[model samples]
Target chain A: MDSSSLLSRVRVVLCRPSHPGNIGAAARAMKTMGLSRLVLVAPRRFPDAEAAARASGAVDVLERAVVVETLAEALAGTVVSVAFTTRSRTYVQPFRTPEESAREVLQALQAAPDTQAALVFGNETNGLANEEVWQCAFPATIPANPEYSSLNLAAAVQVACYVLARTCEAFSPQAGAIADAPDFVPVSHEAVEGLIAQWLAVLERLDFYDPAAPKRLEARLRRLLARTRLERAELDILRGMLKAVARKIP
Target chain B: MDSSSLLSRVRVVLCRPSHPGNIGAAARAMKTMGLSRLVLVAPRRFPDAEAAARASGAVDVLERAVVVETLAEALAGTVVSVAFTTRSRTYVQPFRTPEESAREVLQALQAAPDTQAALVFGNETNGLANEEVWQCAFPATIPANPEYSSLNLAAAVQVACYVLARTCEAFSPQAGAIADAPDFVPVSHEAVEGLIAQWLAVLERLDFYDPAAPKRLEARLRRLLARTRLERAELDILRGMLKAVARKIP
Candidate 1:
């Protein structure tokens, strides 16, 4: 599908996954592209030891995964369904490429805000049967090397994720996209330095630091402030607290 | 721990997390506050059915989690480790509140760049044992509602994530921190108005605006530029080009 239609409101469904690792990887793939919903249908081993280990720290996804008995159960009340398949079939309904399928799904999503759209993939050994392919409005196929189109479950998910992430339009900031604008009032370098100086003055008055000694105390305070990157409001609060401390010290 | 020492250099680690979903959620929490580098010790389950479903879209973190076989493996080279435990210890090394613990971790991270410090959390059923707590330099207890401290795994992660995010000094543009003053130049509203007026003059010369009736062209341009809070350098470039355009307009 075109880039704009792949993000925001799509769910990736796995039917009878034999290996839990693939489920974990698929979840990871979905997250990288900002897609979250994952539905599993009749998995052999779920909450399995191997799956959790492979999922690494992504335990949240596993805890929330919905386990079901059948594809129909998984697709209950879904507005649109797109099936991912490798083999071409002449008897069944026409299948669209991933791009075309994504476009269709995107249109359906826009049309029906309340409805859910699912992209379904079958198990490792054998893919969805003829009936399952026919159940989908359109089949979605990933274009790969013609010589070897055997894509792993997670890899396929990643491809779909990449396509969808680019396609969807959302107001949220893109990953690593930093707008170079002065939107907020900044605590200027000069202001921070002044605050530090005032604090040092108080320390001196209280005889907390030896005047003859090296400027280690000032350097330490500077480093602390610099590393924290304190905001204007935060700095103001800190300065007020320091002043209070100074008042009590005398 | 003192406030300065409490917040020096901090790392948050999840131990034996049973669900991948929680891992994904944990990553989301960490990313929201600009914390990275998650370590996973021998989890009961990984890459499983439930995790992918629950993580929603935070898969990148799952993909990047450093998986290890043992707690020792996870803590191998770290200079300090804070085990998150809910259970009270009678005779263990001193325990600090989450605030104090967070401060200490933050300090360690800052004091010795080479020293790896971590805040470790145990499994779902039971938290880190006394022996496990003793493995670390200090024990950290989160001050929750007195009656209920039974925080969900992801919720615990979220709380720790928030503390680290707040305590750390890294100024992210996304977080609206003015850490890197050198990188940006602020542009004022008046400067933007001046540029627009100059542009309108050129448009008038080019007969782009109707003389008989005023069009909404300037309004539209203003709307577009208003959304973008330009840096000082950007304003200079735009104004410079506007002047060059005005010189050539005749």
Candidate 2:
């Protein structure tokens, strides 16, 4: 399935959220990761100015958000649900890391074209209730500092959405592809050999290399050049320095 | 070699952040993920109430944050730095996704134990200036929605720190390990066979199965049960349901 279609099928359900600004921030976070579906369950205040203000450019997401009275209604028709929690609950299966949860979420969506998934988050302070957590199919945790695992509501949403986007390839950029890096011309062995020769000649002129007692200095220079992987530009700089010193040698 | 030691070596550099709340929020984000080193370059305001209130429980991170006059000062001792940019700049190599950046950052840290690494963020309105980006060894992009790629400063920090934490295993929880999951007792072949037999018997009593022309129903049911890898508790539930159905039939 296409990333957008799959991502669109995944609902971000916020249960009993107290702050309107967080709701706005969550909307912005979701939209920024190409996730548009938002479900608010029992929000203390909706249509608040703070939410709209915090939402910034994601007003459309807030406008289209589905506000429900309960988590059950928010999660209705979702084939699977993963609850984000910091606490360890024994009833639920092993908690998934965010990356694992993203993979599983995408896998489930791909496994069934019509099936929908829900990423359920709880209140800022109380988090998800045990009963509410039980309603979800999976329990996921964002591994954090043992001393301070409390992530702000919107920040948590951003991390989850970011992981999901990356896992699903919602964005097309390759992780490590330097898309605009200059075209690299591989340095030939001949060029390296010439550069080494020039370097040796310069060192000889500077009395750093002695013809009478060579002492494996040339061999060591060759090894150092090979390890450095000199680029053409870098090689030019070295050559320029060598020529400048050779001029002064006379 | 340890996660905390490696994580501590990473510096979260905010270049000319516009808002103090974002500064505080970034501190909270970093601390939650076990990243404590925060360096601010020319922030509009520091030691502000909004920042403190937003920092919430992560005041220590703020208290210890290093404020510098320039990006160079913030990155002085760092062996390598990655500038976060949303724009496509022709000057830098391909933009790294947060995950890739995290792996590379950790790899660089591991390769040189004494070296430090920086994750640089630009101002809220305009991302990393071209000159600032050029100063860093690597450029990274968050792989956000093309339409709305603007992640608030703290959100970006959260994603980066979260990725780094996960990559370095700063937190002890394994990505997929269910530390608190109940010990799974594997179902034996005999147990599976017994459950299948009981299920067939119950089906026969319910008129759902016929022994005279067993039409592959038992075979299909057996195959289904084998694929399920039913847990002991699940097996017991099935048996109790089957027994209840048989009792009703009588």
TM-scores for every candidate against the unseen true structure: 0.36, 0.78
Local accuracy of candidate 1 as per-residue lDDT tens digits, B123-202: 86677764555455556654432223345455556555545544443322123221222333334334566777876665
Candidate 2 colliding pairs, count: 3
At residue B111, candidate 1 shows an lDDT of: 46
Candidate 2 overall lDDT versus native? 0.79
Instruction: Considering the two chains of model 1, state its CAPRI-style docking category.
Output: incorrect
What is the iRMS for every candidate structure?
Answer: 24.4, 30.3
RMSD values for the candidates in order, in angstroms, are 22.6, 27.6
Per-residue lDDT for A35 in model 2?
91
Best by lDDT: 2
* lDDT string, candidate 2, A19-138, tens digits: 999999999999999999999998999989999989999999999999999876776666567889984555425677788888767765665557578899999999998667766666
Model 1's A-chain: what TM-score?
0.64
